[model samples]
Target: MALLVLVLSAIPRPAHAEIAAWMVFEVGSGEVIDQHEAFRRWYPASLTKLMTAYVAFSAIKQGRITLKSPVMVSAHAAAQPPSKMGLKAGSTLSLDAALKVMLVKSANDISVAVAETIGGSQAGFADVMNKTARELGMRDTHFVNPHGLPASNHYSSVHDMALLSRALLRDFPQYKRLYGYTGVQYGKRLLRSANREYLRRVRGANGLKTGYVCNSGYNVAVSATRGGRTMVAIVFGAASGLERAAKASALIEKGFDGGGVFKSHPKLDNLKRPGSVKGLPPDGYCRRNAKPKLEKLMADYAGSAPMRAANSGLPGVRTAFARESGRTRAAGIATSRADTTIPRTRDKKVDWGVVMDRLIGAQRRSDNLVRITLAIDPNAKRAVPLSAPSADDASKNVADAFGIVMPPRGKPDSRPATQPADTNTNAVPVIVTVPTRASDGTPTPRPAPR
Candidate 1:
């Protein structure tokens, strides 16, 4: 970034380079400090889920669905794409589980399953998505597909992305923690987050999805909060993943450059509550349908502890660097990354083949379904160090695997299989732990399985 900053500063005048698009703003207040080609059109890739989740949250609030609402997978929905929850057509997820799947993996099929279950089909839910966007002042955005896979007419501007971020904070503040999912596990399988920063050691950084498509380059919408102050930043189309994070850090610093909203509220403690847990809701269809006991408390904090005491400091948003020895100073920040010098080439065009390897917690051929709740200590990163469940009592292991119980009693269609199961725990590991940033400050690129 210092080199880029120096390069930008050295530019005698603004050059017409396709620099990445980005912006940063205070959530509650509509303050835009730094901006580039924020209005430029770009492909959202998976970031489209932010809108989908927003509408789902709205439905939950409206009593149309519950966290426990059951959404059954349909053959059509199951056929969509990988990055899926891999449930069969007959399987059902509580509304909550469905949300989790979508939030966590940016699963495409689960998005459709939730849409169909809630609105009766994809077209119906899309109506809600577009209308909601209009109301949120996302004038330059449109949703053609529930999952943000390629669609002919789908497009959005970075400016619009910032607008959606603002709405998420203002309207659905209760579910903000949903944005912070680094990785999650279901029973034995490990599902990692695609957001590298969260998987790494960056603190205060929660989430907003990361995305890429050949035409879109790379896009990431990230929000980080410390104390009571929260800032939302968006970076679209970057040359490299490391560059994206660095650029985002700059935008965020610029946003904090002016002043914070919590300046007057000295006692306001910052709290990030349990947001919609990913995978579970969107795939499991077990989101809150009816407000439960202690709903207010649940509303206040979704999952994590709150932060108290605020820090007062400003981080500058620097783009092109200015050499101390040189007389040059960066004029306006450089906008696109499509400079002639930095070649625009992808390592390999993404081949969306066998995208569902992680689905079914590792695909297995059997009529029986295994459920397990593998307790994970957040501080404990390695796989659960426990005696083998299978080597012990088979029935108890089955019970533990499916700890919550099968179709138990809720839905008449819910049926548990008497068929015997494989004893292997068959651990399917998908979550990729991004190496913590070395103190020397160099990014070690760990390729996330596409």
Candidate 2:
């Protein structure tokens, strides 16, 4: 009880000030370590690329495409704003290289480029992202683009983001190395990774991503491993990148130490979520003038063990040039070669085609029935008149227009047809007696009677 109170007190409440939501969870155990407004909707910014990477990875694994496949850059892709790799229109790169550039640089242009290449259009790719997000159980996420650039409905919650982070890490272990890189090299110009702060500073912190935009402030979904345990920490709506990192690092430390008071919290699926609220804008909290305040917030958390032990001062990794500069070193590039034979490992339990066919099969059958009915001669004579069933007969099965019955054989009618009939002889008997009497005189009377 005391421990729960301590944890409850330590964690900020939703109504507390203007701090954004945060959450920490133990990866394997499915225990929610601590949370504050974890399910509130927030703009994901560049963190949207996590889903992009997931979809691409899924495509590669499904054999629909390949890592070495060429991704052509379109004018649309080249036009995305900065935090981009300066990719030009009409240029092309291997999917593997494009992913490296996007993940390390958080390049918006490459994100669009990759989406277009894989989905044939950005709209189509967004559809795939949302469908895949649903499959991964990210109920509170809806994306409008492959890149995390802000759009009206492109938003996700910390719970949803953490679920995605867990899915990416757990589902695609072969790509685990992708999360650790601080940057990637192309030709001559070195490209730096966007998440160098956490990668360099926090012990056991390897990945996964960070994002910022005017609406989203600074956000990150980070995973780290110590001893043998892995934990993911999500921070949203921080005042600055430093604050985001600091808070994440602090939560991660708490997670590793198993310091939460509550024995368990609601599962990710059960967490409360935002309805239709708009995301918080970063202008008020993340603007240039807010740096001092943000820094002061960071100072308070700096004394935490994780921050104190962090190696944030370490120099970032340098990679060789892209588009012209001499080459630099890249950490954690794909070890699995595109040229090597990839084993077919797609799931066998669920055939999407079969599921879709089943969903529409009944409707299609009904449609065919309507078409057949329309194609028949309208003037044709009716085979039988339609009528309502009698009250007692209502409970009985009736043959349809086509004579289909619930059971192939119907019950034989056993009632006698004449059982309700009786001769009406009383009136005719009197007339017969009169005719016998007139028979003698019939010769004369018959004519008058006629």
Candidate 3:
């Protein structure tokens, strides 16, 4: 018999148990409005950047680093992976710009640069982070790196993270502006932050960070103000980014509605840490096989309007390679969209040979279709607009439309590579051969071209 059980464990199967941890606090009154497994250790992921920012803030306050100071991308700093700024080694930006890239882009490499600039090296900066965490009453936290990449020994809990966020707000109220930005502009490109739920949709939400890795699932520390009261909400081990934001938003609404215990919680330092600890490995919780469980949970606890709003862009948020790019590359044709059809000029069906020459001359790797502006005549004031069929639609049935068989693998070249037309083209002629059959029904190969 097959027994199916759905456990919300942040860890994998046979452990059919809840894996999530969370906390909601009232900043003005120091109340633990709500909490769940808040003391358990979990990987902080890029939420580790919060403490990294805090250390930087402390350094800024103490004159160790200033917003205008030079932030150089070192060989070490430039090596951290995406999500990053893609800064090359030896590149530099002001402390202000680096901070924006780190906070808004959640860039891993810039985080390293900030750590190195202020703490003198990544190791030294981590030392500063731990010391700062202790001072801020985050006893359950440890920092092995400035960016929250996977490390066996590095970890934090919801309580500790919430505490660090409070410290950032209270001690450096001036830098509070950094947390709420929707996106950071880098030249012509807009690098959007993953914290869109709080910044764009959630009412009165402001300031904080979001984080993720397969190991961490999703984590966020968020703060919002309503009717003159501000609240901090921390969520960990969520199955997806939207779920994390939705849960955090729900806690914010609940805190404002006076949900959870109103008893005054201990100061951040006095909050007890679990004696023995191990960070939950997210492989079991975040893998592809867990989608059904994730969907059910999303439908259940995450049914709020704001939560639904957060989930609107569910799961299609990464790079996708162009389809024809893949096919042509594999076909050993040039890795570009190429068309040889020429534009008509002066109401004349222009010479195909002449047009093919000009169209091929104008082909570029970045273009999805061929474009030609025909003067109609050399001295005509207005030009005729003509464009080739889009390569984006290259997936049509070649046999039905072009009547061309896909040449078998390991076969000789089908056509000249330079003059290859899109397989989906209707105007181009494609030759297809029907093998001659013997009268007994055995197939016969066509005669080779002379």
10 residues in a row with least lDDT, candidate 2: 365-374
Residues 24-50, model 1: lDDT tens digits:
777755666666666666677778888
Which lDDT value does model 2 have at 154?
A: 91
lDDT of 2 at 365: 15
Residue 32 of candidate 2: its Cα lDDT? 75
Kindly state the number of residue pairs that clash in model 3. Answer: 1
Per-residue lDDT of 423 in model 2: 61
Q: For each candidate, how many residue pairs have backbone atoms clashing (under 3 Å)?
A: 63, 12, 1
Backbone steric clashes in candidate 1, count: 63
Report lDDT (Cα) of residue 308, candidate 1: 12
- What's the C-alpha lDDT at position 412 in model 3? 67
Whole-model lDDT per candidate? 0.55, 0.64, 0.63
List where candidate 2 sits over 4 angstroms from the true fold: 1-17, 260-262, 272-285, 292-295, 307-450
